[model samples]
Structure formats: C-alpha cells, structure tokens
Target: MPNFKLVAPYCGVRKYDKRFFVYYLETEENIRREYIFNTDEDVSNFSHALENLTAFMNNVPVCKKEAYHQEFLDLLLREVDHKLNIRTDPSKPSAVALAIEA
Candidate 1:
C-alpha cells in the first residue's frame, strides 16, 4: 500500500470501479493523495473518520495550552454552519442543506 498523507481540510470520494472506490484528501500544496476502499462499509467508516478528524483539527486551538472540549465543539458547529451557508437559528435546515450534510 502507498503511504498517503493528509495535508488539507477537504476531501472527496471517487468511484474507481464496480467493486472499489477511492477516498482522497486535497493537500495544502494542491496535491491529491488517495486510498482505496474495497467495501461499502469501509467507505462509510472512512467518511465518518475523516469528518471527525477535520472537525477536531478545525476547532482545537493548536497554540493554546488548554481548551474546553464543550466550547470547542460549539465553535466547531458554528464554523460548520457558516461554511454550509446555513442560518444560525435553531430552526430546521432546508432540504438541500440536509441532503448536502447527509
């Protein structure tokens, strides 16, 4: 297996064949590094893991000596909402946004 490095905050999944798919991350240097996932379950797990990793990376302050977990989670959600162009209100999200999130 090729050693892959994740250097970006964004990722994408691409279908490679009937029985295989590629999970790739866009590096900060504009390079795309990919890994193969052979099963649907593997793909799903990869997606979830990547989402959680990025969420933590984006919210946790690297320079800070200490940070509250709850505060970081709240900030992360706010950042996600802003990026998705969703309203800050507690109202239900639109169908399109929901689809995108899913």
Candidate 2:
C-alpha cells in the first residue's frame, strides 16, 4: 500500500452562518476533503476525533486503509446510538441548547 502524508487539519464556522461549521484534512499531494456540520457540538466532536486519529496515525504503523476502516467503524457505532437517542427522546436538549447553557 502506498503511504500518503496528511497535513493541515482545520475546523471553523462558516462566515455566512454561525451555526454551520466546516472541517477538512489536506494531504501532501494537495487533495482536500471536507465535512460540514450543522451543530457546533458535532463539529467540536469531529475536531477532537480528527486530532486523536492523527495522533494514532503518527504512532501506529497501520496503513491508510486500516486507519480509515477503523474510523468508519467508530463513526457507525456512534451514529447508531446517537440517532436512537434522538429518536427515543423528543424532550432531549439540542446541541444549540447545550451550547447556550455552556
């Protein structure tokens, strides 16, 4: 497997809307991939996840395929419970509400 170098992981709010956030990972070959989030909490969580993944990549010898596969599994596991929680609890506080309280 070819080893690709990754750099410049960034996250920030979109200028047009404060509620929207964007994050991306850039590679040495200049390819960029981005994710847009509707909630600040999601963006924050993604940023933390990316940081942890980068750290793991740096310390581990795994290839990109393995790393990405692990991340995909993690996301799938998280989304299942997250979506279920939202659907099961109509009275749950939203990300916006949590942010305001904080």
Candidate 3:
C-alpha cells in the first residue's frame, strides 16, 4: 500500500552486544518509523524478518527470542508515545496506552 525507505542507520556495540538501528519513511503516511535490530540474523533474513515483525506487531510470541520480541514492543510503545504525547498513568483508561502496555 505504501513505499518505504530507510533514511538513517545507527549501531551501538558494547563488548559482544550489538544493536542495528533504522529510521525509515513511508510515502503513504509521511511517517518516519524507527526500528532496532537486536540480532544479526534479523538483519540478514528478509522473510523471517518480515514474519518475526508481523508476529511482534500482532503481539504474538516470538518463540525463544525475547530480545527481538522486546525490540518490537518498544517500537510500538514509541509510536504510541509519539501520537499521544501524554503522561499516562497505569490506572488511567487509555485504550491507546493500555493496548501498548498490553
């Protein structure tokens, strides 16, 4: 439905740990989405990456890969924060906030 492109990339390495960063744009919405790749395999496989990503968005389990799973959850939270721009208390009735929290 939309064409997307990467606009920026950042990497942080600490000892044996590494993070791959991506900032991208979608023409259909004029939105810049950020992504962090937690594992090297995530950077290499287009198919598994897509599947892993979809599963993450749907809030499905990512098998044994907790790091990658958490990355997606964080991205979704950032998106909610970008949209809401509010300090959401845990007790509040924020469907948007609650969905993200979920």
Candidate 4:
C-alpha cells in the first residue's frame, strides 16, 4: 500500500455493548474515505499519530464544521455523568453523536 496522510479527520462513535468509532478523512490528495478502528493496535496507532484527539462537533455533512463545539462538550459531560449512574436528564442531548476522534 502507498503512504497516505489523513487531514481534518471526522469521527463518529456508536455503542454496541462496546463503543465503535469510525473515522472519516480526506487524504492529502483530497481522496475521502472512512476507517474503523477494530483493535487495540489500531486505536493505539491512531492515537500516536494524533497528539491531541479533538472533537469535531456539529460537523454538518461530516465535513463542514459548524455550531458551538462547547455544546458538544457539555453534552458529553452530561452523558458521561449519566453513564456513572444511568440517570436521565430532561435536557439531555441526542442519544447518539457518534463522536469519533482521530
């Protein structure tokens, strides 16, 4: 395989007993593709490439980034809290954001 660099990666996360993360990115040549981290090594390798994995929230069309990202952060906090005890919040965000960080 040829070497490729993925820039401005877009990520989505889903829970199926185990969380599944899918990353979408455009190559240096502008080729778009999606990748799934299927193993510990895959995640580890991806993390190594990204010193800081940041969220691309409210990224409409999964490319054009829009909206206040902090809202996503706040929602993430609430969801994490909910996970701690399974408590429901009236103002909870959507059940799924499919947040993938690469």
Candidate 5:
C-alpha cells in the first residue's frame, strides 16, 4: 500500500459512520469534479486517485519535484501522523513507543 498526503487542511470531510471519517479533496477546475474516498478503503486505488488529482492540480501531466509547497508538505506529514496514531503532545508517548518501553 502506498501513502497519500492530504491535499489541504480543509480537505472536505465525510461521515462514513459515527466513528469513521473520510477526508477528500475538491477539484478546483470544477465543483463537481471532486475526488472523494475514505482512508479505511484499499490503498492502491487511494494512491492512484491522489496521484491523478495532484497532477491535475499542478497543471502538469506528470509528477514534478518542485510541484509541492509547504502547505502540501504539512498535509502529508499530518496524514502519516494520523494513520500512525501519533499524538502532538510531548508528555505522552505514542502507543508504539510505549509498547517498545514495556
């Protein structure tokens, strides 16, 4: 499974269930052209969707090295943190860290 960075801080959110959330990115070219999906789903499709939409957003036919910005970088970091259940608080150790300590 490949990882995908969130496109924006305010990437749209959907309620899959009370306990689940599906964050999506809206296409700027057209309001109706949104790429909506959930994290809990298959990662292969998720990665493909992200790559395709990102290329479109950058107005490039393929991925480029200088296409990303700070905001996008932050979004990618946050997405990984969220997936790994990493807490922002320094006082508390992450579950994985605690497990290693034990």
Candidate 6:
C-alpha cells in the first residue's frame, strides 16, 4: 500500500446531486488520487472523526512544534469540514451542509 498525505479537501454534490466529501491525497511520488465519499452519512461520519482527531491532537503539544502544528490542524479541520457540523449524523442530507444551511 502506498502512503499518501492528505493534500486538499472539498465537499459538494456529485452526479445525481448526491452529497460528496472528497480528499486529494498525494503519494511521495507526487501521484495524486481522489478519496471520495458520495453519501452524506459517510461524509458526516468521517468529518466527525476528523474533527475529533483534531481536537485530541491539540491536547498534546511537542517542543518547538506548538506554534505551527495547531494552526495547521485548525486549517485542515476547517477546510475539511468547511460546511460545519452541528451534530453527529448517520443519515443522508449532509449534516455539515445542513447545519450551515440552517
């Protein structure tokens, strides 16, 4: 399995107006690939997990890395969950987008 780093993230509707959350990951070789979730539930779930991970990471800081690490994480989380999520959701109709819409 190739190791890839998360590069960019975007969410929106796909073909058929299906909700989508897509991440562009790049391998060390500079190969880029799309990791897409077409269902709102999957997108919501993943964002919740990512949000939680970002929060957990903030609690532990390393020497000389504190200044920029949290900023990077905040940017990453905000970008990935651009629409924002009000609560955990497991059904369709994006929890993230829905919250923003409301």
Best by TM-score: 2
| Full-model lDDT, candidate 4 | 0.31
**lDDT per model vs. reference:** 0.36, 0.37, 0.33, 0.31, 0.34, 0.37
Window of ten residues with lowest summed lDDT in model 4 = 93-102
lDDT of 4 by residue, 40-89 (tens): 55445444433232433323454344223324434433523122212223
How well does candidate 3 match the true structure in TM-score terms?
0.21
**TM-score, per-candidate, Cα-based:** 0.34, 0.38, 0.21, 0.22, 0.24, 0.30
| Residue-level lDDT tens digits of model 3 in 1-102 | 112222111111111222322222212222222333455554344324444564444454435344554475466445332221212233434332223235
User: Relative to the unseen true structure, what is the Cα RMSD of model 6?
Assistant: 15.3
Report the candidate with higher TM-score, 1 versus 4.
1
RMSD of 3: 14.4
Q: Report the CA-based lDDT of candidate 3 relative to the real structure.
A: 0.33
Instruction: Give the better candidate number (5 or 6) by TM-score.
Output: 6
* After superposition, candidate 1 runs with Cα above 4 Å error: 1-29, 62-102
Better of 3 and 4 by lDDT: 3
As for TM-score, the candidate ahead, 3 or 5, is 5
lDDT, model 2:
0.37
On residues 1-102, what C-alpha lDDT tens digit does candidate 1 reach at each position? 222223122333333331222222222233222344445665555556545655566665655312343243345344231111112323443232333355
Residue 83 shift from truth in candidate 5, angstroms: 17
- The per-residue C-alpha lDDT of model 3 at residue 82 equals 23
Question: Backbone clashes in each candidate structure, one number apiece?
Answer: 0, 0, 0, 4, 0, 0
- Candidate 5 per-residue lDDT, tens place, 1-102, comes to 012234433232222221122232222221211223244443444445445555555563334422443244346445442232211334443332333235
Q: Candidate 6, after superposition: displacement of residue 41 in Å? A: 0.5
